[model samples]
Target: MTKDWLTTGETAKMLGVSRQHVVDLCTRGELTFSQPGTHRRIRSSEVQRLATSEFTREQEKSLWLHRALLGPLMLDPARVLQIATENIARWKPLQRGDGMATRYLEQWDEVIESGVDAVADVFTSKDERSSELRQNTPFAGVLDDDERRQVLQSFREHRQREHAAV
Candidate 1:
């Protein structure tokens, strides 16, 4: 059976540290553990949290940059366009790129002018054209497919609520 808790050695292996270090962490209460019988056990969740929490700022930055560079290649064009349009509409005036903001706003307007079918076309097409469109767009690469979809869905829901209140 799969275990929810890890033994001290298992936790050490997962964290890339020695068993003694894991023992020390458990002893110091830096890592929470349970003494079930004679052995110490660490919760798998706690190990995951500590591993993620221990990243340096530079490491985090490098990881995000790498994800951004790779993210767009995995996204659908329609989703990307919808995300871009929503983001542009919601962008604050104080943000950088006044000229670029106006241009993006104009593009958003044009997309709306073209109607839902044009947007639907983007969803249906899985061609190189769609990939090319995604590649040309800045900020499209910043979020991985799952993160982008979640953010876009959040924005879409927020916009629907705003429209409903009007």
Candidate 2:
């Protein structure tokens, strides 16, 4: 019966983890599998038994917190902020070592740097005014013919480039 089994991707979806995490579990002897041809196949019964047997306090808490975060609390900005802070705190300790922590630290650093670059982009473009102005603003009626022609020409060129791809 164990000859036909679920693939790593299938098991990962059922277990709510990534394919890499499943691979780690297999390597650590937490999960058992058989390599047939080009794929690793895990027995569903074994996975289910392991899932049911492991009921540690930390695991329970993690599940509950994960569900809560994905539910009604998802719309609450404060809750989102608190959860992000908790994740960063958990990540910091792991970051001190040269293993998974290092990888997480690098990912977090990139995320923060990208955010800074986005903010910088908005400020840099703020001073460069376009020909179009707000209807209620003082510059609404000041647009000249040449400025209007320049805007139309720019738009036409943009459309031409966009349609060329199709």
Candidate 3:
């Protein structure tokens, strides 16, 4: 069976922190870990939770934006659209005052309401076009291009793993 628990080093890598930090978190009971035969092992779920919780509000918003934009490509289209809609709604207020951003969100709302084909069209668009879409998104000003790319790549990898398990 695949191991579901991560060693301190592995957990540190996932959390982008040092091994000692992971140990400190475990010692402080901030992150759950178990000592099995003198080695501390953290559940992968705990690592994910910690990583997510560590994100700044802007990072979280960017994450949700990536999920909304890329999720339908790999998962149930309708479900992804619903998630995207909720994400957009949640961030809309914070995203006000930018005309391009407002227009982009409106476009997403229209596409989501237009049904599955519109969502698919977005997923199937050329890379250049997709990049353009990302540029116009609310997250564009929040996350730098490299950060956005990293977030999208990470989400894609996660979705691939999830699909492989299914």
Estimate TM-scores for all models. Answer: 0.32, 0.34, 0.37
lDDT of 2 by residue, 1-166 (tens): 3535888888877776556657766876778988878777899986786566543222332233233323323355344334444555555675446554345444444433455343223222222110011100111112246754654566557557765886
In terms of lDDT, which candidate is stronger, 1 or 2?
A: 1
* Better by lDDT, candidate 3 or 1: 3
Ordered by lDDT, highest first, the candidates read 3, 1, 2
| Cα lDDT for residue 125, candidate 3 | 54
How well is each residue in 1-166 modelled by candidate 3, as lDDT tens digits?
1379899999988776556657767886878888879999999999988776644333333344555555434566555566668767877777655554566678778776888776566544534334334434433333357756777777667667765896
For model 3, the run of ten residues with the poorest summed lDDT: 54-63
Off by over 4 Å in 2: 1-4, 55-166
**Model 3: colliding residue pairs:** none
The list of candidate 1 runs beyond 4 A from truth reads: 55-166
| Clashes (N, CA, C under 3 Å) per candidate | 0, 0, 0
Q: For each candidate, C-alpha RMSD in Å? A: 17.7, 21.5, 15.3
Identify the candidate with maximal TM-score: 3
Q: Give the TM-score of candidate 2.
A: 0.34
How well does candidate 3 score on lDDT at residue 127? 41
State, as a TM-score between 0 and 1, how close model 1 is to the true structure.
0.32
lDDT tens digits by residue: candidate 1, 4-40? 8999889988877557657767876778999979999
